[model samples]
Target: MPRDRRPVWAELLGTLDEKFVANAVVFEHATPCAGLLLRGEPLRTETGALDRELVLRALAHGLARAPELRRRLRPAPFGLTTPAWVPDDDIDLEAHVRFHVGVVATDGPELPVLLAGRLNPPLDPRRPLWNTVVAELDDGRVAIAWRIQHAVGDGLYGMRLLDALTEADDAGAAGDAGVAGGAGAAGDAAADGPGSRAAAPSTSGASTSGASTSGASTTGTSATGTSATGTSRSTPTVPPLEPGPHRPPRSGAELLRVAWLAWWRRQEGPRGAWHEYWRKPFLRRLRRWGGRLVRPVRNHVLVVRGLTESLVPQRRYAFATHDLPPVARRARELGGSVHDLTVALALVALDQVLPDPAGPRLGVPISRRAARGDRRNHVRMTVVGIPPGTTLAEAVPLVHAAVATAVEAIEPSPSRVAEPGEPSRPAATILTTAGLAHASPAPTIPALGPTKSATNSPTLSPGHSAPGSPAPGQPGSASPTRDAPPHPAAPHPAAPHPAPDAPTRRRGYASFVPWRPRARSLGPALVGSAVLWPVLDPRDDLAVFGSSYADTFSLAVVGSRHVDVDAVQRAFAELVLGTADDVVAAVALPAPPGAGPGVRHDPGDQPGRRPDRQPHHQGGGTP
Candidate 1:
């Protein structure tokens, strides 16, 4: 099969990346990226310290089998086509890993600063777009950092790649050292096909074969003379390779096809009963959609009074774990799911921070992984009004209802559409549950050292600074003055007056008209990183990412200097605590017998779902 054809979805994502790049350059920030920080026990061996060369060799061997790691981007010439992925024949493994001495925690106080420094530089698209940094900490542990471009893979894929390099048992550890070189022989270079356990589009632009085992080596090595197999190798510097030739881009016709396919995919959906109302002519459909749109949340103003932007960017991370069983129980009692509760918690938290009671429309992502033949960037968001000034108990059901309505209207792909009367899965399920289809567990590499979860600080004090106060040129805490100009890109009111009430729903997404003033897409974007990739954009006023592991919940909040971190932290703490209080109140009443507190339930489980599960699709504007 020809490997030059690019998948429509991949090309669409690459085109979006180009837009994000342009936006970041104009806004003085880097394009959004995803990262992982791993820390583990010390790497030690019976003989002596394992050298960096062995570690490099093992990683190089593993990455060679993972085609995504060896695939550099080939841009389309003259903006005529979308970017394509091609094999990188000349890879320099040594350039990707940075060696550091001392104890570095993955979830440590110093992590944000360190991560920012690494992220400051834009990725060189000419080469494979990723890097792994290794650090040996004073605590006799090792820290590994993985950074990958969003276009290459999502969070689930990143976890799988990490798993391939790890070993869970001593026997597995013994096979790790030599595993790197021999791993490539296990490569399955064919495309990932529909229903394959491992999914990645082949260079031929088809989703066919499963992932190659070349990237899944058992042995890992570190500088402490320890390998995953307990062997040690002499230290030697790995030489860099000469750069490969640049490949020619696709034709303009292909670029046009890519854009057209993306648009068509955005409108795919089932022809179901709920959509019957949308089949009317243009005017009739418009009138019916207009009425339903008002039922959703209202869009609020972006600029708040008494707030200013800071020239520097800042981040504050906070971690806490709530009892999942109790929270899950409360959601069920309210006729909602755990996912609904998470969104409510976010909205309530925003209300506490924003000057206005009602918050801005949120960009809520809905994963489209069920789509056949689509192995890349299959996510669409539904914009909805935030329910501020409402209690968790009152808001839970409302947000749940609103989300269900929005998903039904916005999802165009048939794979994601629910059967008639079948309830849509809560977007929150991505964060609240474990055992998602994408995650795989593997053993630790001995050379890299045994891995462990980093200790999380119980609570982040308001206004408290990270261990390294200000990294190099970063600014210390300070309030911005009114004179500080607002972000040039974000929507600003002509004056600082109250924003008008939510406008009537327009027919053709009129608000996005290039001629009219538009709302800034640089405001806060919430991400639940428990399962999906966490998108961190430097230009946003605030980016909040949350993850729940074992019995702990962690939050990493990144903001520009213009925002108030102390105030936001206080509000966030209150919101989380408030939810816990609600859970405690509900613990007194046991759930109806036979209903497990955490059993997975969906619309199909409801008493009166239409017996025929399939729903019909309709043609109309989405809310």
Candidate 2:
């Protein structure tokens, strides 16, 4: 019996978030996109508009379009939806977008407030996968935020939906619309702070379909030409992309097409694509599992974001390129490896922030083989150990300690006896995330990557307080390098007394793997952690509250609910940069690893790197 209506699950799947699933989807290149909201109108009046009608009407208009907010979803085999992403019960326009106008008992200018609260609530299997939030910023702007699990569809697929709903008339204007929803502008109510992509130049096209940002973690680097022993490895051939009926290729389709052609590619070597596809057949027995919930249209919320999302404008963000050539040159000067410097930097960052910081006071992801037999692009996670905080004087030795711990963590190979013939992920990953190392330590980070440890990850995002995401060097996340730990220029030169953990140690950022390949071709996405606690330390008072964002640099501020962003940024500079006034580092790392001795970090880089004859990542794992 063919049914005309979609099953309940199918409709629910339509509301699934694309960003969530793309987290797990590995990429050879291409960064993911994230949603950014813009305020259509600013509430300049202080007392707020007393007329409930217009405010309510606008709210109603936004909510009415909830179920209509749609995205094509990809279901897993056996009628199972990807574990990531969920839909909410229904949309509440007032809740999602608010007019802060409270009943002042006096009618002044119409100052309707936008609700900053959103629906990123945790969901269970019994319900759909999604959330809606009506976030009211301190300013009159409002933003609806959501975080979908990363187990659904690719970002491009999400864009297809936007194409369907968006207007082609002005499809290429990267300019802001006008006052509110206009291009490149976000008012206080617009949340995501200022200068967000939401505030970027407006999308050239009308992004009618809800926008999705994926591949939100990690930075882009030259992966093609690396100097391996002073000789470059030939760049491998990338497969071409085949255009689908639903979504056509952009004129710059060369790259994405390359990625696609690589996928489902024919097996040329000894191993062939399995003789047959494995299909789970539970539906034959109870076929109506999801079908029983079939309905004409499933009720869900629609999400939309501006192309030029703002960054809350506190501080510029960072990619691994931060130090670039300068740092690389400096590392060589110190007679150490580049990755060694990275380990040192991670430690320095931790030491600067953690209160009463003691022992390594850090976490890292170990790459282990996958549990499943598949070995395409996958990795399991494991935790690495860190000693307590060391004085800035003792930086090098401590960095070395952190490196040794990382080296030790990647040692054990996968156990074959009990787990034989199962799946095979990455070796460094499994051992780290299984919680074995986390539970065994004096001072250690919790498991995070793939499974999320504390708030932090390998690729760190700006967190006013506890900042951790699937960033590199986060616990159980991804470790960007495999190398010996090189010591920093220890101010003390001698080892410091062994220290113990402090109350703040309990609040350390959890670990995660932040290795992600971002393609400038696709723009940026969300991928980090943050935690804001109620308790303010005495240090918080001495702490400064100024600007962390300089002329060109910026970082992301995410996850934390209670972080006083300005204060946090100030603390970062005072503690990390040595002084709040020093917007740029007094001593900057070399720009682009291996650049000329005097070259500063090049802000305006071309689309690709120079076609050097060397290959930098011969044995290097995916970033």
Candidate 3:
């Protein structure tokens, strides 16, 4: 393996981030993959079966747009250097594209079960690290599930790949289609649900489409990759790959030479060779060492708790979706970003199930790529610690500040140094946001005309805000007056409460693991923590993924067997749709008889109980 014989991107091998290489190595047993699951009108043939040819054609079109899909990893011998991306000359469409014929209802357990089964297996490492399964349901609808290895690309990249595959549309048409039923029927139905359908005041005219956007969230299960009408748009010309086999460095000496060349090339700019090669590393090391000496003891405890919980191998998953505009508006009114609100919601939910004295340490993945098309896994993990007993209102600002600090301190590459007396593991709970897939010109919330001082304003509930807060020069404010009518989407003071079915309507769909009397746990010290790996780190106790599609914000919760993922999902929904008080009361209710441990009782069925609570303990079995 010589440098001259390698591909054009060969020089990047040694300079690759350690996180990227770690992701490749971890693929041996665990599948660190992000996925998209979409339900829509079935694509059929003259004989009334799934149109396999059409599906394959569309996949080929998309693969051409995303060259990373056709690339496979070529590992270094004896771990001498990072893996190199090489072109796969032959791709087996039949092996990668699969079809399952069944009547799997969107709201039923069958869909999730089928998806889990597909995700349980690892992708064929010999070829590309991506696959698709098109399922035909009994109701004449089809569900498309697409997955790609996290090592290749991230959530944003997945959205770009999806955008390339689906039918093409101008920005306006895409927005309109997304608002209608283009994204998915489930998302559309949920978006129109009571108390959650109000349009946010926007300077822009685009309606929120249900179509998955480029900024939509990518979780183990994503709804952002819907192929509207299952039609393939015309394929664009893709540049051909270099015509030769990729050869990675073989010997230790070659690896060093490659590393040195990559480093030297990076220093050729104005930064100068001496400053970059010597001064910068020394300064960074000194700062890290100083920070470690002053790092709090509580941080150490949080890391330990996360490590202890990571030993459990068995995991469960849950999914839920909510309208994004209203939530986004509410978050804005509360003086925080949508991301801040989501982090607060997740922390509150985790606190309900696992109340730690030192608070929960959250691992937030920050992307470092300059463009979405970069196939390299350029990401850094930042850990944020939330203090115990913090309410939703209190946590928002704290989380915002902590996240700001962590983001500013992130290094371009993973650091080898560890703080004294701390286990180098990821936070116990990991929270990730893929961002809005298709962003509108106007902000999610309409601009407030004018308003009084912050101290003089009325205090709103945790998840609620006044329909239209007065802006700086508005008539209702203490400042200059201006006449302006209220936005049409604003809720009236006398508006009727949402019907009892509101809870069910707020969520597009949900799936939880049934409680088993004898749930097994992976013994201690079997896996590494995310601090040393990716978000799909083997040691994670719970990982919550958030993404947006059109007007909808989707959440996917992945947790260990001992954790009650169902409870977390329910808590999050209630917190978003109802008040904090309502969540507390609902979570306090007892479970109905015959409902297994960790199963959430339907609030509609149990008249007095809230919809988010779990049953009381009976035996020593895990929840």
Q: Tell me the TM-score of each prediction against the true structure.
A: 0.50, 0.34, 0.52
Q: How would you encode candidate 2's per-residue C-alpha lDDT over 1-623 as one tens digit per residue? A: 75323222222232122212221111111111222222212312234322233223322322222222322232333433322122233322222222222221001111010111111222222332232333232222222333222222222122222222111112112211321131112111111112232112111111101001121211111244221111122222212111111221222232233333443364443344343112345553244335323311121111122111121111111111121223334444443343333334444444444433343333332322222221111222222223444333244334434433443454432442433653232211111244222211111112111221211122222121122222232222122221113333432243333334323222222221121111001001111111111111111211110000101111221112222232333333343333444322222112455666533222122123211100111000111
**Positional deviation of residue 256's Cα in model 3 after best superposition, in angstroms:** 11
Candidate 2 runs further than 4 Å off: 1-126, 134-144, 149-360, 365-456, 459-507, 510-568, 575-623
lDDT string for model 1 (1-623, tens) is: 65644332223334333332222121223222222222221133334242455556555545643656766665544433445665565666655665543344322333333332232222455677776555442222233445565555433234334333432222223335444333233332122122222111112111000000111112234456343322233335654432233322345455556555554565645454336425556675464344334321221111122111122233332222232334344445554444444545555555455434434333334433333222333333444344335555555555554555544454343555465854343322111111211111100010111111111111111122223221111111111110011112212111111246643111100000000000000001001111111343333444343333221223333443434333433443444344322211211112233757542122122333210110111011000
lDDT of 3 at 129: 75
Error of 3 at 617 (Å): 26
Which one wins by lDDT: 1 or 2? 1
- Count of backbone clashes, every candidate in sequence: 47, 177, 19
| Candidate 3 local lDDT, 159-262, one digit each (tens) | 34444344221122332333222111111111111222111223221111111111111122224322222212223322232233444455546655665576
The local distance difference test score of model 1 is: 0.33
Candidate 1, residue 266: how far the Cα is off, in Å: 17
In candidate 1, stretches whose alpha carbon ends up further than 4 angstroms from where it belongs are 1-14, 21-39, 45-58, 105-108, 115-122, 137-140, 153-338, 369-372, 412-500, 503-533, 536-539, 548-553, 562-623
